[model samples]
Target chain A: MSSTEKHIVLAENLTVGYTPKVVSEKIDFQLNQGDLCAIVGVNGVGKSTLLRTLAGLQPKLSGSIQINDSNLESYASSKLAKELSVVLTEQPASKNLTVQELIALGRQPYTNWIGTLNEEDKKQVQESLTSFLLEDLQYSRCHELSDGQLQRVLIARAMAQNTPLILLDEPTTHLDLYHKVQILKLLQELAHRKQKTIMFTTHEIDLAIQLCDKILILDGAENPFGAPCELIEQKHFERLFPAEMVLFDAKTGSFKVNK
Target chain B: MGNLKPYRFSFILIFLVLGLAWLLNISLGSVAIPFKATFSILFGGQVDIESWNYIIWNYRIPKAFTAVLVGGGLSLSGLLMQTLFRNPLAGPFVLGISSGASLGAALLLMGASLITGFASFSFLNDFSLALAASIGSFLVLLVVMIVANRVKDTMALLIIGLMFGSITAAIVSVLAYFSSAENLQRFIFWSFGSVGNLSTQQVILLSIIVCVGVLLSIISIKRLNAFLLGENYAQSLGVSLKKSRLIIIIATGLLAGGITAFAGPIAFIGLAVPHLTRQIFDTMEHRILIPSVFLYGAILMLLCDTIAQLPNSANVLPINAITSLVGAPVVIWLLVRKRKMLF
Candidate 1:
């Protein structure tokens, strides 16, 4: 551990769920810059709730979340937009928008009232498109892209937002195994290279285990946060799902269907 | 995505169409002024016939102006509605602004006789009609704006607006039931819609109201663009959802209500113009669609108004009738041609 590194996101005893209903509580976690954390849990276990709370989209039932030393709830939306970006699971309303235009919207927080992108904004958008391997698809309509390509464009949009932190909810839900791994690998590289704190919820335990720098596990047992190897040692995945449905392989750090 | 070729082509084509439609509309009416005479009079040259000058300057000019302004108003409202609801089928009238206007008109024209002789303003007076219509539509707009802030869901707001429409329609029905035959006929005539009825004063007032709505739309253009991704995404971009919702509701209400007050309920133009604009442009960016829809909407209204005043016949069709007849078929054709929902 680097003792001098600063924590970008800090959450303590967060209780998140729908209105008047509590799903989970006493969740404590902290992520330093350049740390790629994955929130892993079974379906309906409140992974999305936790992410939404951290993103400041949903109000937390109880507990505090701080981003870059400021309270998440206290920052004005536009000010927070500059510090944190989010990629949702659902698709946008219209697919008629071009990839470049869609990506250009990431500069909304900094753009003039009319949303005109200046030269610096354009340069950032271009760099994101090129770095994300979306240069060729920049001119294509969003509706025309493959699912994988769309996800990459969305990620590029967040990168263009120039936020210090990014949170993606179910970023790999519908992709095939190869595409899922490819996306996870790309996210891993983005976090390490850019030194941006990135966190996403996923069910791809094996890929996440291999790629993520830190694993935050929410299960029927105690919520655990640590390095992936440490999490594997603690057998967090064993408690992740019903044993009757899937079994965790401690040696492989993967889940397999129980015989 | 940055391709300018298609945008440049469409812009030039729509502008040319507007110019041609303007010239043709001014020239064709009860009497053929001849293209040369029309051009001369338009450019400050005195024409041979004096009545031609009166007709062109006094009547045709106001009529054309109303068509353009009312058309632009309706289309801008429709564009805002579709953006707010995220559905192509949404329109200004769908929110019941027209019904509200009708209720106001019905109260003045029909309810007057139902209540008492003293209560009944002259049904034939245009001033009373405009006043009542504007009041009624403005009242509905205020209610709709409140409901918009309360409800986060656009679909629910649409249904609530529809409920408001039915309630107003019910009151109008009661008024119509009690009205005398002469008053009923007057109300029916007013409902048929006439673009030529606006006096210069009413047209000027209408222009001011429409300008207010257009200005609001301009300020909300960026927020509307973020809306293409839905509310959650828009909020993420730092848009004040409450503020945006209020601004949009007010703008839509002003445009729809103001036009209905001056021109009666002009149908189908509000709903159809935006769809056609989308089909022609094949893009959903509000920055492009707002201006494009406004220009195309103006051209469309001019063409429809000209058709209503057929060259030789004295029979002037109701502006609403022409719009619906032409607008409905074009939308159907575009739908069938695309074979998919654009939204």
Candidate 2:
């Protein structure tokens, strides 16, 4: 459709995996402006691989990924940096960095050669801090903050980057359930309010169903992505995991273990 | 900006200690020049005796100068390596860089002396030793850069480096076994590590190389700070990993290699000084840590060199022994206290 043509990400027959191993092939997806999408699947279903491929950290096994109508591989690294931002699952080597200091690092790509933050850059960082409700914790060292607070700071950094597309790998990996939902809801709010495309990989299926505008379920050889209700209507969520004890309920948009 | 109160306090304290250490190193050697005479001689003013002027200007000044550069350079490299590999125990030698230098020195000091029967050429004229050390460290740098590309994990890279160090050290031991007793003593004396070894021209060369290293370090601080959060986070923040890693490896090689070539592989100042600076400054920001470590390292090395002189005795102790003795305890204490750190 003409509507999907103005996408932030336009992937055509994209195949993704590490070198010498192809996980998925001939897959296509278009994530349009302001779309908050979640890639949900069981463990080892290549959710991370797909996110990484799209982030341009790893080479796409086969096919093309275009951002802003240009091929992903065609952009220079510095140019690609401004267009795409990523939040990783790996833990930082904490050296007692303050919340403000950590968030300001997001301006690195935009900053000059010496990495000095200009007046406008500082203002964006401040806005990100306030919007994330991290003004109070801005002076606190990362080690002193709770997991929830640190996760918020990471997301704030992503927001500060001001990229069109934000790729996060398991943003809620270490948080409590409440914090997990809190983070997801915040991201959902940002996607609509800022008119940015945000895609993240998560195992939090129910929360993804509730918060994401579109759900991308990474099943073997299938690229199921559509409006959450559409995926539920088509019974794609039910086909997600072939586990004996677990089941997906379309009415609740959640999973239950048959105990 | 965060309040500069801590930075201000540490700056004054480190500067004061550095001044005191400099005075101590100059004034109270085995031949005790009076404080006034040492001061006068240092300031290019009148001293009681001409010999006292020579002692202060020729011997102690160059010695103290060497200490400052060696200390400052090694500490900077240590902090860089520790952050790069994200391992606390990783030091200037963790990558076998210094070991590579020692290997070169060993081949010359022990091996060549055995084969050619020309050991202890002149204790003060260590031209061969310096050249051997430089060549050896450069080879290791090459090998390290090659291996660094192949391994992504820091732990794997460190282990590979340690293996290389072990191999080189074993070769040194083999050289030592076949060498004569006099050659062994000369080699041991070289291993003892002296700050007074460099002549003025050598110190000038050392300063030039170390200046380049320190400048490179300053340039890499922002990237290194990002790296404090690990490689993935750094990459996500748009840091070009391969490029940054290359710069770090080369910068470290220059810093560590230059010092070892001139200063005889001095130990533990690199390992311990960065930790001390971090603990004292209470911040891990590389911008602050670089200057802090440089000043603190100079102070500590000057202090150690003083102790090694033993003040009254003509017999000076080996510097490596003193550094290990003083440094090992602080590291142990830090580990015992923190209990929850790897980087």
Candidate 3:
């Protein structure tokens, strides 16, 4: 571990869920700048709830979440917007917006009151489009893009937001294997190059192990957090699901169907 | 931002068309005033006919102004509702603002005579009717705004608004059934909707209300654009959801309610003008959309009013029928040809 590295995110015994019920609790994790992390768990294990809690989309039931050494709840919404951006599972309300217009919307925090994009804002949007390989589709309406292209556009929008931390919920859902790897690799590149702390929740355990700088295994308890090799050495993935259904193979960091 | 350049010419053309349409609306009414006379009168030049001046000043000009305010206000509120609710079908009347006004008008024209046994009291003038409708719509808006604060789901708020419309509509029908035939006819005339009867004072008041609403809409342009991505995303963009929602609701209420009170619930213009404007201005930016919708609606209203008066004829059709009859088919044809609504 790099003892001197600055931590961008720190959660101490975090508890998260809806108002009436607790989905998960006693969770602990810390991420340094430029780390690309994944939270993987079985269905209904509060993976999304934790991410939403961290994004300030929902209030945590208990425990503390600190972003850049400040309480997550301390920053005003407008101030928090400058610190983090989120990509969710829901599609945009209007598909009629062109790709360029949609990306420009991410600059809402820094733009004028009427949301007129200044030269700097325009430059960021252009850079995001180019880095996300979306320049060709910039003029096309969002409805015209394929699923992979739309996902890229969404992430690019978050990039244009120019926040220090980015959160995504299932950014690779509804994509084929090649596309999933492409997106994860792109996210990895974005975090390493831009020095942004990026985190996402996914069901792709194998890919997460392969590409993520850090892996958070949400098993409803013990909620192990560390590098992939450490997690594998600790046998956290083996306990992810019931042994009769699927077994985790530590040799290749992939799961196998038990017969 | 550079995308706005291509749409500049379209805006200028629409503005010119709005001017021409305003002129046409003022000129082509039941009386055969020549276009030259109309243009001269409009520019402070005089024609030889004295009564023509009276008709133009006292009757046609106020009606034209009312048409512009009603059409532009309704379309602007419709655009706001569509963006706020993120539903293509949402309009100014979706929150029952028009229906509330209708209930108020119905009570004034019919229920008062039935309840008091006075057979339409002398105190209930056009101004009083407008006041009653305005009060009713304000009450409904207050309730809807309260409900909007409590309900986190926008779809639920939309459904609740629909229920409010249904409840008000049921009450209006009950009022209609027990009233006398003369009272029923009075109520029917009010419901038929006209842009012709507003006085100069009422037009000035309406202009003020619409201006306030337009100002609120202008302030909301940034938040409205964020809302095109849905409420959660909008909130993440630092838009205060509850505050912006309330502001948008109040804006829609003032525009829709004030217009309905004066013009008596004209239909189709509020529901269809935004979609029609989208045919030309393809972007979803409200800065362009708000103005484009206002101009398109003003032009369409002028054209519709001109047709309802039927150009030099004594017969005048109901403006509501004219709007729907002329507009519904155009929307249908556009949707069919385009294979989808741009929303």
Candidate ranking under lDDT, highest first, comes to: 3, 1, 2
Model 2 regions lying over 4 Å from their true place: A1-5, B1-9, B114-128, B141-165
Angstrom error of the Cα, residue A25, model 2: value is 1.9
Off by over 4 Å in 3: B116-123, B138-166
Docking class of 3: medium
What is model 3's C-alpha RMSD?
2.1
| lDDT (tens digit, per residue) of candidate 1 on A193-225 | 999999999988898898998988888457899
Candidate 1 recovers a fraction of native contacts equal to 0.55
Using lDDT as the measure, the top candidate is 3
Top-TM-score candidate index: 3
TM-score of 3: 0.95
lDDT of 1 by residue, B85-117 (tens): 776667767777788898988888888767776
DockQ of candidate 3 relative to the true structure? 0.71
Tens-place lDDT digits, model 3, residues A3-103:
78778899999999998799999999999999999999989999999998999989999999999889999989888889899999999999999999999
DockQ of 2: 0.51
